[model samples]
Target: MPTTEITHALLAPGESELIEVAGNRIRIIVANPTLLVCDYSAAPHFPGPPLHVHPGFDETYIVLEGRLEVTVAEERRELAPSAAAYVSGSVPHTFDNPGAERARFLSICSPGGFEDFFRAMATGDREAIVGVSERFGYEAVKTRG
Candidate 1:
């Protein structure tokens, strides 16, 4: 195994680097080998990423403002302010903003590197996004209409 460096990160609101993907803005708060933290903002009625499974990392979402509909596996629930949800690795999950106002939240992934995947998708190329997601052990599942 290789050694990894651990560094400290301090980001005030609007200070982190923001990347846009599929109409959502994601600010990378931390992107180290052990953990990845991101501040996400989505427009109203935004359908988030496709239902996907991460085979190498667990993800947790902390809702900061507005409401979000989070679906894990086959279950779904609405989260309000200050609410949180956790999805373990290999679980299919996705989230969406169902409120009329913009939604903001913190998304944390363990055993970090998901930020890189998001960055690749920021280019808005479908093929590139799929390739990067596959490289990161992410599998997208087909959702029902």
Candidate 2:
């Protein structure tokens, strides 16, 4: 059997690549071909992107502080600290910070690389975000007639 290389990272506090889009903050903790982890903080009325889906990636969101309102397809819930939600690649999902306090959460994406999108988001260009999102197979949900 052949040996496979492993990827690893050790980032000190405040050492991650931080990106702020709109009023939310995304700190990229680690990004590799197999995994992408980010620490995200959102203010109330989050202004999250539209319900979207990643055709080639699986994502998980875990709340660390305050309250988060997560919607996965037709299911919606308010999650408190320590709560988590798993979203399949093809599912339409989005989230918001419904409470008055800032909400902190972790976002883990498999087949890692949404970091590129976050980086583009830092440019504060909607067109760039759309382009990058498309390149990564992450897009807004389509409506059915």
Candidate 3:
């Protein structure tokens, strides 16, 4: 399929989604076989709590707006606008907005398919996330969503 720009309104709106990660509102700005770019909004009212990881794909997060508290492995750091972070495959990572304002960022995942994982989570298809994770060589285990 050709690249598509999917907005947040086009996605299933809620407090939590699988396709977008736990603590953010994700809008797929671009999607194709090679790459997927998502726009994430971490609002102050949103409690960013989900800790998850990717197995096969590496991802880069570029802060477009506010600040965020990012935790990768056991280390935690704060990222400001224009700053970026990278998460390699098999690394456990999570983040939340510590600032009072909304945090916006562009997250690009290489090799694309992780988009489906997020989509499944947003649509309430747990099996799809699990299946996709298994095939991709990583899985997200947590006590809550």
lDDT of 2 by residue, 1-145 (tens): 7755665789999888889887888999988878999999997777567888888789999999999988899988999999999999799988888677899999999988778888877787788778867866887885421
lDDT, candidates in the order shown: 0.86, 0.85, 0.75
Window of ten residues with lowest summed lDDT in model 1: 136-145
Looking at model 3, which ten-residue stretch has the lowest summed lDDT? 9-18
TM-scores of all candidate predictions against the true structure: 0.88, 0.88, 0.72
Name the TM-score of candidate 2.
Answer: 0.88
Per-residue alpha-carbon lDDT of candidate 1 for residues 1-145, written as tens digits (9 for 90 to 100): 8876676877788788899876788999988888988989988899887898888899999999999999998999999889999999688999999778989999999988778777777776788767767766887787734
Candidate 2 colliding pairs, count? 0
Considering only N, C-alpha and C atoms within 3 Å, which residue pairs clash in candidate 3? 18-118, 18-121, 19-118, 19-119
Q: Tell how far residue 108 is off in model 1, in angstroms.
A: 0.3
Q: Is candidate 1 or candidate 3 better by lDDT?
A: 1
